[model samples]
Target: MNRRHARRQGMIALALTGAMIALAGCAPEPDVQPTPTPTDSAVVPYDGPVVFVGDELESFLLTPAEVAEAIPEATGVMNASAVLEQVSDGGGTAAVPAICDALFAEQSLGSVGARVTRWMTPSDPEYGQGRVEVLQFADEQQARDRMDQLLQAAADCGQFTKEAPVTFDAEILDEVDGVRAFAGTLLDIDGGYDWRVFQAYAAVGNVVVMLNQPFTGDRTYDAQAAASLLQQRAGDARDALVADLTENPPVPEEQPVTDAAQPWSEWAIGVDGVGPVLLGDAVDVAVAAAGGTATPPTFDRGPWIVENPEATASMLIQQAEDAETVWYVTVGTRRGESAETPQDGAALPALGDVRVGMPVSEAFAALPGGTIVDVASSGEDYYAVTTREGRLFRFDTEGDAADGTAIIIGITVEDATQRASLRFG
Candidate 1:
């Protein structure tokens, strides 16, 4: 009505609008539903009777001529019934009907079963590991299709080479009401015939039924009568895919180092007092009290024996590539010592690093074959020399000194095979 009243009404309306907007912001949104993915309906799960079923593989069937070739003795049989009877007679024992029902009764035709048995024949390497698949399949089609895939998978995994395929063919057999009953040449695959067959019947729909016999053995697996005996124990699920093949061990890579790659100078300790000893010189400074030198006289001790003398001496001077120290032979008869005044030992006067691949070995041999000596390996390349004194003197090549490291050459012997192992430290 009045201008002020109208302004107040407008303000109230603006406040109401702001409140509505805030409430809308705080309210939760509706939850969105996820889309369902489509899956194939043809994938029949592995039920008890039918282990596996492949539409394409099941369609494959052998012709009458192929069947006749598979079983030569059944050639003159008038009908399928005659062949069936023969197969039953060959199949030694009948399986319980209840075992067959568990595999096929509840499902469509793609069921599978297994049987349990021991493989004791000489031809079977797994004879020690008893085999069992005491289950059944809905019918022959399902059984054959699954077996084909399984066999192929095994071959692909290199379990069996293509040139050598494991084969088993037997006969089909059934007893009607405890009396002898028969089913014809039950199944044939890849040139192998099976006369001993265990049937797993499945009622797909109405009167349409399927019989699957997972274990079928031909004459090769056993003679006619023997084949039948194998069937009596049949009626179990197909073998589980747990144990199919083995694995291969891994091989290590090879690493080798040449003579030029050895580290020698790393053994160099310091070049102070010990350096002159290896360089064939000795030094004397002031002594706290005073010192004196000793003289020696050679004696006729015939021969002297020293064990690991050179190695022990080298160990003391090994790291002294640049140092010097006194060296002396002790407690041995000298070659020129008189018997009346025998020489107990001698101060060699000076010590030097025995260089190898040169005149070191020759010099040591000139003194005597048994004379102990320190040998140090040296060359432009890497090298190592062990003297008669059991000392391992290592010398670094130019590259080794530059790298400031040592190379280790390891030799391994395995089963008459000699291999060289190399490592850097």
Candidate 2:
């Protein structure tokens, strides 16, 4: 990739996030594509969007505490789905340029995985809300190339359509805390080309953290003030994520595994249910079966969350508008050396002795005809196994394929759905 050297040479003051921050979607089954033999071209990543592979990608995302630190005056914190809305902005009557479409955050950056954090600050009216999002590419090269695309968009795109058509102009700001920054302004076509909106961007290694402070109501828009605020927050967010990942790399749950008389071990996961829990089971019925308590949903259509009595494990139940029927169940834990109950009373069976914290290869052997969606790697990876009886078992694991030990941290049992959102694509 070639580098762009042209610069205006002064620092612009900065401002961006999505629906749920981190791996926060409760949408049950993911529509996966077969793994294509990978090629050398950076332009074409894979035949399909390589996803559910990066385990730490979620860990790399900013946390609520971090978001709070950035927006001290925030009234409240929005859930993960809000981050999705923060990043996605290409809806209107015309074809908006990709750059202008993602003035706040770039949801379609084509990364392997992404995590986001969002907040609302009513105190500052000019910049209504605030957001911080971290996007992860497969490697450093892909991340750099994606940054180049964003910069190009900023430099070339000056016009796009919103509810009202507008003209955009960008100024490349100085890099702060090792993150390249940019300031952008949007002018109304009907309002005599006056500045109406402001946003900012920060491009770092193998990641792009963005900030957005959109106007809440009609207020005097000051481009410099908005830029400065966005810049400070973006730098803070980028630093926080880097420090979190560096200081606290995820630790695998390597607990003792003693084969004991358990309940779900003898039970096989079929298209029906594990034991008493079956598909189309109501929320109360499913929670009763798991012996867990149901918590409130975070987002509007968020899944029903079930917590164990001891809060050791969790189960996410997804059901459409009929109150609780037509259910999809999800539960996971780190697979140990052998079949061992993770917590004392929360004896969640290994779903026929196959659980997380175990090698993905073992899961493949246990459930044959299981296809590998993304190539397995060291940090975090995923594998999807479909049973002969039409049951889908998806695993998100840590470790490496070279050592034949990618430990599972998350697993879900789901049926197919057409309205599912693509995480990577």
Candidate 3:
């Protein structure tokens, strides 16, 4: 067709389509957009204040030993809900002193968690060295029960004594160790219970709590009064806590898993020119010539060092000539001595020395930061083992490695386990 004819045809088709649209405007139409589904991201994280370690109050109904042992065998494998279930299993009609009725029950309140802020001993005149511990339980019911028991014990003890005519003004110290309660009680022999008060409330689930209150002998204040005070405080705290929790929740922190053996190895030893000799497997020496008896040092979990005078003579000469570091590593010795600075009697020659103790890990930690140079080579082990301070430590078997008793010479004291396996440099 010619161009003019085609243009005319197109115009006619456009007119027809416009006429159809105009007619459809009078008819009804169906909805086009579909309903949107919600996602996890659509829900926000809990908005709450950062809980300081020492902000909450914890009262224990059980002894420290009892509470510590209360975890089920399967706790290590359980989730939060599972752990909570286990905790609630044996927890009976115990009330929580630091929470409200609305928030104290596990069934109603759910689980809460927090960090430890402070620990203290109660200074009440009657009790001596009363041990109190504070922990942020993962469940509000847990915290409440702990506090409830604590208050109950205090009140029950107070009821034992008869009323006395003594009355003294009480003081509350903000001490972390709970000495304030003791000190206050001591100031007035008459007003014992009145001198100290403990209360717990929820601020946030992740908030910190204090545990340290000793029971002193003088029970002058009304026990019921003290218990009431604790209960009220707990209620107020719980409400505040719930409001805070509903607004803001705690976020899990990123925890970094570290190679326990190599954590300090590079920075503390091998990478920094700490050693001039690669002493993993290349130490040779004559026992008698090395100045001690012709016997190898015994290896154990404790530190290792040359304790014999005979070995000292040989090792000192070698160190003086080579200007290289020597070591005695042990696993069982106490702190304050290391390979670099052994106690005068503790450090002997590596050669024929009697086994003097050397704190292996400490010595490694004590090395002047830029000393050991790490050498990468497989030691005498079939499986992989970590190297520390440029020295790859390996024993004859995995059992030795697990216990940390690898014997080699020219090695500086690293820790107790390494100390026992001393070889002459």
The global Cα lDDT (0 to 1) of model 2 is 0.49
Q: Residue 364, candidate 3: how far off, in angstroms?
A: 26
Higher lDDT: candidate 1 or 3? 3
After the best TM-score superposition of candidate 1, give how far the Cα of residue 6 lies from its true spot, in angstroms.
99
lDDT of 2 by residue, 306-372 (tens): 5555556555666754445634565653232111224322244455567645676677677543333
Over 318-347, each residue of candidate 1 has an lDDT whose tens digit, in order, gives 111233322211111212221233221121
Return the lDDT, model 1, position 383.
26
- Cα deviation of 216, candidate 3, in Å: 15
Across 1-425, the per-residue lDDT of candidate 3 in tens digits comes to: 44565555556666789765555443345445777897655655444432322123332122333222321111122111101111233222322232221111222111122222222233433433322222333333333444343333333332222233322132232322111111112121343433232232222232223322334443343323333333343344545554655566644322123232331121112311122221222223212222332223344222223233323311211121122223322211222222332233233222122122332222233321111111122221111112211122111221222122432223332211122211111
Residue 294 shift from truth in candidate 3, angstroms:
22
Q: What is the TM-score of each candidate against the true structure?
A: 0.15, 0.37, 0.26
Q: Please rank every candidate by TM-score, starting with the best.
A: 2, 3, 1
lDDT of each: 0.24, 0.49, 0.27
- Tell how far residue 121 is off in model 3, in angstroms: 22
Leading candidate by lDDT: 2
